[model samples]
Target: MRTSFSQYIRFQKRLLILYAAIMVFISIMLYVEPTMSIHFSNLLYIHAVALIFLMAYLTIDYYTIAKHHKELSSRWSNGMFIQDGIGAAKTYEQQLYLEMLQSVNDAHQQQLTSILQDKKESMEFMTTWFHDIKTPIAISRLILEQAKENPDNESILEEISRIERSVNQALYFTRTDHFARDYFISRTELDTIVKSVVKQFAKEFIRRKIKVDLHIQPVVVETDSKWIVYSLSEFVSNALKYSNDGGTITFISEEDSGEVRLSIKDEGIGIPQQDIRRVFQLGFTGTNGRVNRKSTGMGLYIAKKILDKVGHRVTISSKEKLYTIVTVHFRKGDDYYSIVK
Candidate 1:
């Protein structure tokens, strides 16, 4: 209300000055007219009546002129947009402003839509390319397997596996945004998924001479089996990457109070305390990455994203140079299918 009054006062200040000036001229004329019969008391009475009438006119004009200003002020204070709850424009300038704002909004929306469409097309192409490239990678691996067992063949096979992992990572990264369309939720066996992931990395295990201590019970979870397998493979790959020759990687599962926890603990060069907090951040190669020199830093980040979308929780705990344990928690009663829907 105070703001509206101030606007009203500013809008009419020029007219108010003109009115005061006319009244002053009238008073001067009445004073200087010696031949006139008007007395000083009569002049004072006339001036008082004129002042009352002027105040009445100002009150009506204030309400008439400041009505729109008051409405706009109320909307702004309440955190509403200019187009919200504001009725038809009372002036040409206001109408022009509204039309201009609407045009700009429309243009912005079109530009944003174009950008998203381009990104979707790019991801679709990349996903197709990844799939196409995997055919040749598989052929290469098969050809290498058929050859004699030698150190060179083994190294070539390892490099091929590395390429395959990289391609799969890129494919999954693209699919992350389109997860709603790609994933299906069902009652999946947790142990089966873990074994499959381990099988996928069996060569890596053998090459590193790392022992797998699987203690998983026959636990089941409601999640997308494909995504869960990929996520677990990422963790297992990380374990194999950092584990020393003849070291142990333990996989344990336990259920308590309707919650199931699956842990992958590795005896490796553990994460530094300062780097642990940022390990899951995208493209953040921490102290361990510096030591290994092969970390793309997307494995844990992608795993966490997939787990969260599946309504599962993942936590990591580590002691420097001792052990790093990554745990995935699943609640038996959660409606994970709702997330897919």
Candidate 2:
């Protein structure tokens, strides 16, 4: 109310000046024409009455401004459209400003829509290109497998495998943005995914002479199996990358109290204490990543995003130079169904 009154007074400064000028002219006329004898008290009374009426007019105008301001605030607070919220304008200038605002808003919305369409088209093109290139990669791998198993061929095959991993990583990263369209949630076996991921990384295991210690039991949970496999593959890949030759990598699974947990513990170079907190951050390669030179820094980030989307939890614990443990937790409940829906 005070704010509206202050605004009203500021806007009516010209009217106030004209009222003061009229009073000054009347005072001069009364003083010069002594024949029209108006007493001092009567002149004071007249001035008081005029002031009362002026104050009454100002009070009514202030109330009107205050009511308009309150209505505007209420409409905005309730999330009403700006054009409708402003209500009918009382002046031509106010109407003009409202029209101008609507024009700018329309232009802004149109530009935003165009930019989103362009982005959607670009993502679709990249996704198609990745799928097309994977066909050639698979054929090459097949051709090499059927050929004689020479050292040169094995090396070439390893390079091809690396390329395939990179392509899969890029493809999955792009799809994360549109995950709602591609996923189907169902009850999937946990050990099956673990075994499949371990098999996928068999070459890396053989090349590095790393021992696999599996202590997995039959465990099942509700999830999108494809995404779970990809996320687990990323974790296994990280384990293989940092493990020393002939070192031990353990895969442990446990189900208790309606909760399932899968843990991958590696006796490799563990994460630095300072770097542990930011390991999942996008493109953040810590001390180990810099030494390894193969870490794209998107593996953990992508895995975490997929896990979060599927309503699972992943955590990491490590002591530098000792061991690193990555664990994924799946809670058993109907809430899992709510995630995809």
Candidate 3:
């Protein structure tokens, strides 16, 4: 926007002093023509042309410098200058721009880091809170059992038991995200753990008139007992949830190569082909879940998480109208032979 030489010029004081010195030298040369030049007219003409060219060059240079400075200033105003131009800030404009950009980027990064830290802290708090709440729930269940004989409020007791189960599910779901920290690998008795979990569902099996077929041998393997128990429990619970009254559920364990596999099969309303793969996703309740509104869709997700932590894998297969089978494969290690022996 600055068109004139004086308007675009910077360091005005220095430019003016230099111009004045040049003019004074030229004037002195003209006055002492006898000593400086024989043809004074031609000399004066040449000097005038040289001074005009010098002024024109200065004006053009001033405009180029001013245009770049304006651009730099606009970029700073819009907060777009977030990195230096890979060189030292030589100009006054460049120095200001570099400092502004560095400050903006530093503040932005700090804010992002603080937000992430807050989220991590919140999740940690929830995990601890859920763990602490479970102790009281278990104690309350014990107290209710002791008092059940005196009162005829069977429904109330059942509801309390359901609450306890829901709380357990929630706690397990919360812990799934931190599974690596909780797993402890050791030799675990397959038969004992399976029997214990089956016993927990005895009342449901009886109430539904469902039969259980246990084809388990005294198999042992190196794994996390708590996680394995929970995983197997989830499979069994799912079987019970979908199986018709009088349907049979089968529990089997076998050894092959260097590994052990446990499977749960149920004569239930089987999953559709499309839904089998998605069942393990968090909060993904399939079509059957829509029919059975009580499904939280967290069970299998937590089961998979627990299994993976202890180096185990789970697979699901189902026949549309007949049955669903869940198989757990435990990894073989040096401890397997010793435990089986």
Give the TM-score (vs. native) of candidate 2.
Answer: 0.84
Q: Which ten residues in a row have the lowest lDDT in candidate 2?
A: 332-341
Q: Write the per-residue lDDT of candidate 1 for residues 109-145, one digit (tens) a residue.
A: 7999999999988887998999999999999999989
- Candidate achieving higher lDDT, 2 or 3: 2
lDDT of each residue in 81-171, candidate 2, tens digit only: 5746588775687799878978997898799999999999999999999999999999999999888656588889889998999999999
> Each prediction's Cα lDDT score?
0.86, 0.87, 0.79
Strongest candidate by lDDT: 2
Q: Candidate 3's residue-wise lDDT over 107-183, tens digit each?
A: 99899999989978987887688778878877876777778776654556566667776777777877776666676
Off by over 4 Å in 3: 1-109, 149-152, 334-341
RMSD of each: 4.4, 3.3, 11.4
Error of 1 at 177 (Å): 0.9
Looking at model 1, residue 81 earns an lDDT score of 51
Compared with the true structure, model 1 gives a TM-score of 0.80
Model 1, runs deviating above 4 Å: 1-87
Clashing pairs in 2: none
